[model samples]
Target: MRIQRIQAIAISLPLIKPVKMSFEEVRNAENVLARIETDNGITGWGEAASAPTMTGETQGSMVAAIRHLADKLEGLPADDIPAAMHRAGQYLYGNNSAKAAIEMALFDALGQARGKPVYELLGGAKRMRVPALRLIGTGSTAGDIAETQKRLAEGYVAIKIKVGVDTPEADAERARAVAASVKDDKVLICTDANQGWTPDEAIRFVKGIADTRIEFFEQPVAAHDVAGMARVAAASRVKIGVDEGLHSLDDLRHHHQLKAALGASLKTIKLGGLQAVHDAALLCEELVMKVNLACKIAEAGIASAGLMHLAAAIPSVDWGVSLSSPYLADDIVAEPIALSGGYINVPTGPGLGIRVDETKVRRYTREV
Candidate 1:
């Protein structure tokens, strides 16, 4: 099947509740929706949730890149996703969210055409369901502890604590508080600093929480300060992981060469889309390192479904993924993701396996 048309939809959907993170407070999901229609009359949907503080892209820039990329992808064969995406990279640089949206739509179309899920296209599903990580907000100690307690009760194997918004002492206290409350032997507690700390501050915080039994620390220093990250990894009480600091496979390779981090969290948008994420995860496995599948802060079903497929196929993703399903106000799909006991089942049908609702799309979509 050949690509016939591409449409970019900009949507701002309110969160179920505002989530204050280490970097910024997110009140809603600012996302760009990519709609691709093939000549064979197959339609596929994808979402790119723009996080200015994280991915450094905005809704306006994402939409612009989407339009330009759609025009560039107008006449390509749907199956040649890599080629299309590579051309898009040449057309525009660093609009990963836009490129990811376009690539996802192409994958959706390809999967639907082959009568398989997107994961099957990348690699066959390794499991039916994958466990998820509960990311607590950067709120008060009591509130954060309560949420952590609740998720632990829900049988989550992992939890992510948000830190670095306060003093190193305060952040260490917060981490210790959650660690003290979580008594599950199976639960692995982690922290995402969102690059909120300097190298020295990161060291101080990690040293302070050395007794908290943290499984890993994510993106402690600035995103580009790999040298600083290396310093933290060498001295940290726990493993040092990174998310925002590593974007593409090249970035992953660089980190490996430097041994900059213990592990990494790969998002579809950060890697250009489905294929790239799978490739990166496999590379991490070969390097004998942990990989985490993570989605944007607040996601619509399209993005979440895409994430589920990737998580399902990657057996190397041992730590568990962080998803925003429970935090979104509503989803654009008719059937939301299935979550039971902190485990998410990958979609079973063709393509992304979630039916997009035009009604919700129209309801949530707005001009940026």
Candidate 2:
């Protein structure tokens, strides 16, 4: 019933292909995994895939924060997740990822103890299959066009193309090429700028693509520029979805007031953990804003399960999920979480349905 120990592991898992977004390119996923042990001998697993560019915490800082909070969590009841999050936040400033990691472990422990999946514990599932979207990296125009065609052929109806890595004209040309290559009018095309454009530039770039069938544009301007976001959203013909900007509930409220974003891209790690993400989803519903579940460039184990549960519970996730493909990793869970017909089946077991291969985790664990 009470916490006994908190163990943190830092692993660097190589990606099958280097993932490039407008803001950064990554070859390996560095994630901080935590396991919390209870006095009754139950162990719960969690992961913090912090984005130093986004959350201001790297793998090292997140692990240290988890270890620092070990004493405070030792005697606390694992079921009191809200209380734990409050205590962690009150004592440590800007450690959302660390708090999220621990909070996830607590939820996992409670779910396992009660013999229920995490989604049922949060709220019952709303759908059996969650729709997903594929991300096309910043490859050559010809290569990216081919990739988009390939993904469409593979049953991915929705595709998000990475832009903002080059000149506005160049990015627009690439997007136009991909849009043209797919040749499916029903396919949803979205562009992620990854906070790479200036407000004026974003307005111009998005305006150029306004005539196309693109569904929405994500994080075009800098993450902190709410005013710029408002300006761009107000001027652009396409709807805007904010990702890095709406990291917290307060941030969501601010964007709502500004009318800066028509949709929100919520990620498990960015909100700190699942509970925070759940709170955000509920808030978005209350505000009548569309929600989109996004992913960190983390391992498949926690990210895949967390996103599946999130997309299943939310009512208005119109843009689908932007999770990294688990199939893109050389080493991951024992059974691959495959995509079928552009959707993923929600897991139906205790806690997170997928089991983690501890041996594989150990093999990738880095010595500190």
TM-score of 2: 0.96
For each candidate, the alpha-carbon lDDT, in order, equals 0.87, 0.81
Question: After TM-score superposition, what is the CA distance of residue 64 in candidate 2 from its true location, in Å?
Answer: 0.7
Question: Evaluated with lDDT, which candidate comes out highest?
Answer: 1
Cα lDDT over the full model 1: 0.87
Candidate that would win on TM-score: 1
Clashes of 2: 0
Q: Which portions of model 1 miss their true places by more than 4 Å?
A: none
lDDT of 1 by residue, 98-161 (tens): 8889888888889999999998997798888878888887488899999988887887888998
Candidate 2 per-residue lDDT over residues 26-55, each given as its tens digit: 888888888889988888887777688878
TM-score of 1: 0.98
For candidate 2, the 10 contiguous residues with the lowest summed lDDT are: 325-334
